[model samples]
Target: MTLPLFPLNTVLFPGCRLDLQIFEARYVDMIGRCMKTDSGFGVVAIVEGDEVGSAPGEFARTGCEARIRDWQQRPNGMLGIRVEGGRRFRVSSAQVQPDQLTVAEVEWLDDQPEKPLTVEHDDLATLLGALSLHPMVASLEMGGEVKGQQDLACQLAYLLPFGLAQKQVLLEMDDPTVRLARIQVLLEQLQGDLTA
Candidate 1:
């Protein structure tokens, strides 16, 4: 399917929330079209480039669909939209419009079966609970409670302080168990640093 692409410096995982301030004419028009059509846009991590202005950039081929959850007009005349990450997809081809809006043909990633929260997830869940209390995280309304191990794994992988590349890796992983295992290792290393 074809999608309007929004390349950002951050990686957006399925089931996470992203808040964007739309100012540029290209995106302003894109959001308007999406809302009118009741469709969503694709969000990819920018390998290189600025979010504003005409900046030549490279973006990851894999990304998530961002469905608008709420929208409002800002006092500064900007569009404020809160979006929740939807399905994962891989971009097959991309084209940029003269107005700097990127559009791409993408393939949707399939959802994996749900897994129960295992004992392996205990530390990561605790960490996620603590992180969720932070003001920035709290604003996303993710809260401490969520359903399924897959959901918890995806959210934590997105919320953690991992680099863009690392987060991208997590986003590309199809298995929640493997993702949680990777997160547990990262969490252990982070905790180890604290004690030293």
Candidate 2:
């Protein structure tokens, strides 16, 4: 299916939330149309270039669908919106519009069936909870809660300050179990780095 794409430097995971400060005319119009039709826009991670001005040179093929949850006009006269990550998708083709919005034809990805969080997930859960207390995270409805393997994985993946490449790997992973295992390794690596 074809989707209006918003390329950003950040990665958003399913079930997580992201806040956007949109001032560009292309995006403002895109968001308005999405809200009007009660649809969603695809958010891709920018692999090169910047979020503002012209098109980013490259973006991850895998991305998330951002559903508008709340929106308001900021004091600075820009649009501030909160969006919830819904489905995952892979962009097969992309086209840039005259206004600079990148539109893509994408294929939706399915999440593995829910898997309950286990003992192995405890440490990650603790870390996720702590991050949720940050003002930016707390302001949103998500980036918290370790309800299941999928939730824990997605939430943690989105919350961690991992660089774009690592984030893209997590987004491309379809198996919650494998993703959880990888996260476990990353968390340990992070812990080791901190202690050393």
Candidate 3:
């Protein structure tokens, strides 16, 4: 499928919500067209270069589809839109238009069948519960209940202070169980560093 790309410094995982402020002419036009057609744009994490300037020099090959959930003209004069992440996709090829917008041919990544949370996931679920209570997370209004392993993994990967590269790795993984296990190890490392 062909998708207009929004390369950013952050990674967006499926089933998560991200609020974006669109100011650039290229993106503003892109978002308008998406909303009109009830289509979505691909959001890829930038590996190099800035979000507001020329097209990013490099970005991850994998990205999430962003479907706009809400939009309004912000008091700051930018278009504020709330988007929910949809499918995962791998970019096969991309090209920059004269307007500097990157469009890509991508293949949707297959999602693993949903698996219920097991005993081992209890700790991770608890941690997510605590994180959800924070003012910032609460403001996103991400529901309090985790539906399954994929839900648990994606939410944690999106909310935690994991590095961009780490989050991107989690996003690309096809197995929810493996993603959760990796997150557990990363969490341990994060705690260890905090104490050291």
Candidate 4:
């Protein structure tokens, strides 16, 4: 299916969550259009340029099909939207539609199988315990809430001030097991930093 493409510097995976401020004139229109119809949007990892372009090979191949879970009109008059990530998709090609949104030919990625990887849940526990100690996270009261394994991994990856390269790595990983492994490594690194 083809969709209106919205490319950003950040990458989103399926079953994750993202909050965005829709202040840009083009995207404000896009959000309104989506709300009027299916209430969904296509989020692509930005390679270059400000908006999704016509070149088929230009944008990142993989992205997430996201739904607007909640919308709020900010005091500044722009919209604040909380989007829930739905599924992964690859942009085959895109073109600007008359309504001012860029439409992309896309193929959605399938959900990866749950694997019985030999994980010590203690690793995750250690990480969350450490994160709870951070002043910023503590102030936000994100410490005690129970996040599922997959959600925990994704949320930590999102909140960590990691570089773009690390984020791209998480996006490129197709298997949940592998993604969990990468998260484990990142958690270990963060734990090491705390001890140092």
Candidate 5:
């Protein structure tokens, strides 16, 4: 499928959630078009660039396909959109389209590994559960039971006060188990620091 591409230095994975403010003229049109269509768009991790709109050929080949979960029109005529990460795909090629939007020909990836969560595998859960109660973290824990470790990881990865570098690490790691383990370590360190 032809996808409107949003390239950023950060990566997005399936079963994750992303919040984006559409301020660029090109993206405003892209969002409108996606809203019109049945299926939405894609976001690739920009590997070499600094951030969004820096340059092309700088993004990673694989990215998550996203659909608009929710959105509202902002006062500035842009969109405040919440994207729920769907499947991962590889960009075959990209072309600059008519409305300054980038259209990418993508090949989708389907490898959903459902490993049941274990207490031994998820030491992060205890800290995340506690942190989820904090006023600063409550917004992220919305809409679900606390038992989902995948959701917990995604929420904490997005909501935790970590730098982009740390998030990029989580994003680039293709193995979900490894990512969770790393996040566990990071959370432990963070908790220790906070208590110290």
Candidate 6:
């Protein structure tokens, strides 16, 4: 399917929430079109270049589909929108339009069947629960409970301070078990760094 791409410096995961401020003409127009059509857009992580003015130098082929949930016009003269991440997709090809909007032909990633959280995931789930208490995380409204392995993995991966490339790896993984394992390793590395 063809998708309009929004290349940013961050990665989005399914079942996660992201609030975006829209001001640039290209993106404002894109958001308007998406809202009007009740369609979603692809949010790819920028491997290089800035988020504003001109197309990104390069971006990860894998990304999440962003569905608009709420929108408002801010007093600061910008459009504010809350979006929920829907599905993962890989861009096959992309090009910049005259308006500098990036559009791509993308293939949706296969959905992994939902798996219940194993006992091994309890610590990670607890970590996510603790994360939810922070004011900033609370503001994202990521929801109250972990539903399954995919949900848990996505929420933690989205909220953590992991690098863009690391998050992109998590986004591209199709197996919840493997994704959670990778997250565990990353968390251990983080803990090691902290202790050192």
Predicted structure 6: clash tally: 0
Number of the candidate with higher TM-score, 5 or 6: 6
lDDT of each: 0.89, 0.89, 0.96, 0.70, 0.71, 0.94
lDDT of 1 at 164: 91
Residues 1-196 of candidate 1 have per-residue lDDT tens digits of 9999999998888889999999989999999999999999999999988888873489999999999999999999899999999999999999999898999999999978787787767777887899889999999988478677789988998888888988998899998888888888887887798898
Q: Please give the lDDT score at residue 122 for candidate 6.
A: 84
Worst 10 residues of 5 by lDDT: 139-148
Q: Worst ten-residue run, lDDT, model 4?
A: 50-59
lDDT of 6: 0.94
Candidate 6, residue 160: Cα displacement in angstroms equals 0.8
- Runs in model 3 deviating more than 4 A are none
Model 5: what TM-score? 0.75
lDDT of 2 by residue, 18-46 (tens): 88999999999999999999999999999
Q: Model 6, residue 24: displacement in angstroms?
A: 0.4
Model 3 per-residue lDDT at 130: 94
Q: List the residue pairs that clash in candidate 5.
A: none
| Candidate 2 total steric clashes | 0
How close to the true structure is residue 86 of candidate 5, measured as C-alpha lDDT? Answer: 81
Comparing candidate 5 with candidate 6, which one achieves the higher lDDT? Answer: 6
In order of listing, the candidates' clash counts read 0, 0, 0, 0, 0, 0
Tell me, by lDDT, which candidate is best. Answer: 3
Query: Can you tell me which runs of candidate 4 are displaced by over 4 Å?
Result: 51-58, 97-100, 114-119, 125-149, 187-196
- Quality of model 1 by C-alpha lDDT: 0.89
Error at 118, model 6, angstroms: 1.2
lDDT by residue (84-135, candidate 5, tens digit) is: 8887787898887765567889988664465567767555566566666776
All candidates: CA RMSD in angstroms?
Answer: 1.4, 1.2, 0.6, 4.1, 3.4, 0.7
Q: Where does model 1 exceed 4 Å of error?
A: 192-196
Off by over 4 Å in 6: none
